[model samples]
Target chain A: MIGEYITSNTEIVESALTQSLPPAWQIPLPLRESMNYSLMAGGKRLRPILVLAAAESLGGTKEAALPVACAIEMVHTYSLIHDDLPAMDNDDYRRGKLTNHKVYGEAMAILAGDALLTHAFYSISQAHKVHGIPAERVLAITEELSAYAGARGMVGGQAADMLGEQGITKLEELEYIHSHKTSDLIVFSLRAGAHIAGASHAQLQALSQFGHAIGLAFQIQDDILDIIGDEAKLGKPVKSDEKQQKVTYPYFIGMEASEKKVRELTSQGKEALLQANLVHPERLLQLADYLMKRDH
Target chain B: MIGEYITSNTEIVESALTQSLPPAWQIPLPLRESMNYSLMAGGKRLRPILVLAAAESLGGTKEAALPVACAIEMVHTYSLIHDDLPAMDNDDYRRGKLTNHKVYGEAMAILAGDALLTHAFYSISQAHKVHGIPAERVLAITEELSAYAGARGMVGGQAADMLGEQGITKLEELEYIHSHKTSDLIVFSLRAGAHIAGASHAQLQALSQFGHAIGLAFQIQDDILDIIGDEAKLGKPVKSDEKQQKVTYPYFIGMEASEKKVRELTSQGKEALLQANLVHPERLLQLADYLMKRDH
Candidate 1:
């Protein structure tokens, strides 16, 4: 049943994403192709699923959370596009396909990412105009989103991450990178759902705590997967964190410790959700378990 | 008087921008430095000034539009940074100095531009939180901004401009590039101010007409200046447009015809402004004239 729930939601999210973006043909061919290359390439669709699951658990319809969910996905896609650039992660493949820059060239890749980032807001705005979400909440959510994604949040985290690998990594520095680069947006995804659902302040705060824990757990699991997950299954090389001579959860604290950390965080996240008095937290809790153990 | 107005407003905008961004010493040093390099570099500050001028013309306080004005500048600065990348415009200098990537490396330059573009919305959000602007109006303006700046607007324009240069030039294709790339934001600046000030529907439509005319006129003048303007005053080298064999107004229509077109558009813009029945048109008119006749 949980698998069915996630699968159905993933399909729904993909459909919404397809419909949300300006028709690919409406923009220049190259730019739209580059954007679609990454966006449509298969991934977990975890971020948007989190948005819907959180909203549903908090007593909001998937329809109300659909736009916000898609916006979160757009932001996620933009980050992936930029992070894969030659100057950044310098990866040639993502999800087993050529990276955007490889096909579109670096300039077009950058532009495509820029378009996706800008269009995230456009998605929310459209929802407001036609879907009839209250304009005021949309404005507040927009403000919150910018804060979560901009210099002080995701971009800031990315910058720290670039700087963090220069030498022997300190735990504090690593935490800063993971929490901001990974956790900030994840936390924002959950809160975006809660915001649309009109959750009380206490509920919102609890969801934030839950998301932060799950986000950290998610990254640590990724670190673990890089060592143990099948390369074909993950759609990229394994042990890249080790190959790069960079710090990761297992590298910093040992694999056993990393595994323990993920377990503790997952429990904490679920507990926080339970304490928030949700009408249906089972789907989200199941999702956290799935992501924590996912090979990819 | 016009010169004094521009100078004073420029100072005001520069101060707000400085105050608004992350401190240069925040989470990452290189990222902030690269963002500041282009943002703080000297230019005419035309976009932000137009924003303020539009607000003043429409009977809104300069203070009310200040944050929005700064946001526009951030967006402009981001565009310039991306446009100068090796795969794009491939320029080494802007505003008479080394371009951002030249100074900070390509990765940092791209990240900095991304940071600025994301931060533009943050700046507007802060204004919404503190400036006592009505939330619904802020929402409206935010919607309008996404339309003007997203895939269908500035991004779309840049894409068309890039493609238009690959083949024979047509006036219609050239106009699409100019209007979207150069004028979309210009028009957005004017309308953002009007939306905040509660312009009537008729007045808003007229201002849109005014902005469109001025925006077209502005690009034509830029094309002209690329040939006839002083390189020292303009900062970047002149004639690069011709060097690229790009379709430009002067190259396509001849300098005399282009100048005449600019004059006609400027007259149309001013006529539209007069029809809007603005209480304080002198400042905007003066600004437009200055832009039209500018040597730089």
Candidate 2:
């Protein structure tokens, strides 16, 4: 049922994303192609799913959360596009496809990323204009999206991760990178969903706590998988962390410890969610378990 | 008097911008440095001035418009940073200083640009949250900002310009590039300022017309300046457009024709503004003249 839920909701997200972009003739061909290329490239749709799941748990309609969900996905996609640039990770592939810069060229890749990031607010604003969400909630979501994704949140995290690439001597530094770089957007995803559902302050706080726990747990699992996950399933080679000399949870704490930590954190996330008194939390609870166990 | 108004408003924007970014201690040192590097770099502050000027022309207070003004400036600065990347224009300098990528490596410059773009929406949200501008207006501004700045607007124009770099076949294509790349933001700035001030539908339409006319005219003047403007005042070399083989207004038409076009556009823009029945259209009227006559 959880699998079905994810698949169905992902379909919803995929459909909305297709409609999100301006048509080809409406914009320059290259810009349109570049933006579409990355956006349509497949991923798990985890962030947007979290948005819908969180909203549904609070009895909010998918209609209300869909635009913001797509917005979060766009933000995530833009980050991937930029992070894969030659100046950064120099990644050649993502989800087994040629990276954005590889196909579009670096200039188009960068502009495409820029366009996606800028368009995200437009996507979020639609929740109010088309879906009849209140102006106040829409504004709050906009503010939160900026805070989570800007210098103080996701970008800040990315900067630290880049800086830490030189040398990560401390676990706290690693945690900081993971929390900001990997976790902030996840937290935003959940919080945005809750906002749309009109959750109370306490419920919002509970969701935030849950998001933090799962986000970090989800990242640690990625680290574990990098060392042991199947290359084909991951759609990339394994042990990439070792290949790059990139510091990771397992690099510092070893595989057993990393796996243990993921389990503990997933439990903590579920506990937080369970305490939130939602009409339905089963799907989110199952999602945490799935993320903790995912190979990619 | 117009010069004094611009200087005073620039000061207001300067102060707001100084406080816009998260403090150094709050983010990674290098990322903080990169973002501040370009943001703090000075320019005419034309876009923010347009926001303030348009708002005031409609009898709106500067306080309500200032945040959105700063947001517009942030968007402009981000575009400049991205445009200066080695993969793009490859410029080494801007505003008489080292360009962002030249100073802070390409990776940081890209992230910094991303940060600024993301934060601009956050800044606009402040107009509603902090300055008590209505949420509906803030949401409208957010939508317009995305439209003007995203793939279908400024980015769209930049894409066309980049594609045309190989060979410009027509004046219409050149106009398309200028109108979208340069003028879209101008129109957004004017409309956003009007929204903050609660301008009537007619007023917004008039300002849009005024923005489009002046935006094209201003770009034509740039083309002219590139051909015959002073090197010292221009900061960068004159006729660099020719060096780059860029298609410009004067490239298709002679310099005299281009200059005449600028004058005609300015007159039309001012005429549109005069017919709007605004409380203080004089500043905006004078601004069109200033833009037309500007040497750099």
Candidate 3:
């Protein structure tokens, strides 16, 4: 039922992203090409769709939320690029194509990632001024983004996850990693969308909790997919996480336990949305349902 | 005479910069540490001082402009970090210490640079709110920052500078490289300070021009120092740029002509300041004088 909204919003978000990036003919040819290459490589556009949907769920128009929605996707794409660097996950491909470093060399890849990150702020801060949204509102949204995306949030989570790979793996530590590395930006995207929409304090709180739960469920589902999903659809190598000795929900706990936990989290996420009394949460619910059921 | 003001503001700028970064005890120990190591390595803090001094010149308090001052320094420091990476200039030492990747390895260095850049927006966006400045003003400053600091400005300049090393370099191309690479942030910092001070449009324009001239003169002087300065004081090997076959003013023009150009640019910078009729222009004049006379 909500697929129509998703399709339309995805188009809006993709166009905004394509328009937001600098063209290839710019002085820095390879950097822009590398950025566009990864960003243009197809994905489901889930995070950005959530941004638009979250705003719409709180009575905001999709058109007004497009800038930030695109900004979040840029950030997500940058993280993927950096994560796939030789010093990190060491992956050569993402979404079935050469990762940024593989195509443009490591230095340009690093610069491309840096450029994308800085451009995200640029897009949100300047690109949206034409829409006549209050700069203060945009300021608040950009601030929240830096908080969730930066060291104390996603970067912090990534550091911990990297450190954890070599050492002990407590469940609580894993939770911290999942919640911050994955869920923090997810929660921020939702809140940023809601803040733009002028969602109330209660509603913001509800979305925060809902996004947190969904973020964890999403990661767990990823873990499950790595264990059981097909090689072709997953793009890169399947079961590579296990091969890399990465900590996963199913690795520590049995597959059944992980499945039970994802189910519980999905229900809890929907319950949080219900508790908020959002006027139009049907779209959000459908998005959550799709995530909960997705294989890749 | 104005050296006292520079000293005091440098202290304030340093202290504020120290406080601005996420602490080392945070989950991302290496990222924060690498960021801090470079940021705290102690440069002149001239860019940030211009921010504070420009504000004070227009009847604004230093405390009010501290957040922006710190933010600019963060951006500058992040650039240095990235520039020193093995993929870029590949310097082993910066500001008299091991470059970040030389100490923490390439990946952490890259991530640290990313974290600092993102955190600059976070610091500027959230930290300045407590000073009771309107959020829109901070928003404006941050937006200006992303514009000048991102691809169209500094990054573009850097890419040109990098590519220029490998190709035919025109005089105009060199100007574009120097103006964007070295001058954009300087201009942005000065304008940002004036913006916070509520300076008139005329005053901001004057500061922008002043910064532009000073930035070019500063880079020219740096080229001169590379040829003749003491290695001990410069902190790295002298003539390293020549060794790397990097472009420079003295390389294209004779050293005498380069020195003559710096003198002209320095005088032009002060002329802009004089035309502005700033209330407290003495300190800025001193800064220009210092830049003109600096040898190390």
Candidate number of the best TM-score: 2
Give the TM-score of chain A in candidate 1. Answer: 0.97
lDDT of 2 at A161: 86
Task: Compute the lDDT of residue A284 as modeled in candidate 3.
Answer: 89
**Could you give candidate 2's per-residue lDDT for residues B1-296 as a string of tens digits?**
88998889889999989998877788888988888889889988999999999999999999889999999999999999999999999999886799998988998999999999998999999999998999999999999999999988998888888878988898889989999999999999999999999999999999999999999998999888888888888888788778888877887889898899999999999988887889999889888999999888
lDDT of 3 by residue, B11-44 (tens): 9999888888876666467778878888888999
Chain A TM-scores of all predicted models: 0.97, 0.98, 0.96
Q: What are the per-model DockQ values? A: 0.73, 0.90, 0.69
Clashing pairs in 2: none
Please list the residue runs of candidate 3 whose C-alpha ends up more than 4 Å from where it truly belongs after superposition.
Answer: A23-27, B23-25
Q: Which ten residues in a row have the lowest lDDT in candidate 1 chain B?
A: B22-31
Error of 3 at B222 (Å): 0.7
Q: Which of the two candidates, 1 or 3, achieves a greater lDDT against the reference? A: 1
DockQ score, prediction 1 = 0.73
Q: Following a full C-alpha superposition, what root-mean-square deviation does model 1 have from the true structure?
A: 1.4
Docking class of 1: medium
Shift of residue B49 alpha carbon in model 2, Å: 0.4
lDDT of 1 by residue, A137-214 (tens): 778778878888988889999988886666755787888888989999999988888877877788888889999999
Q: Which structure is stronger by DockQ: 1 or 2?
A: 2
Per-residue alpha-carbon lDDT of candidate 2 for residues A1-296, written as tens digits (9 for 90 to 100): 78899999999999999999878888888888888899999999999999999999999999899999999999999999999999999999888999998998998999899999989999999999999999999999999999999999999999888877879999999999899988899999999999999999999899999999999998899888878888888888787777888889988889898899999999999999989999999899999999998767
CAPRI band for model 2: high
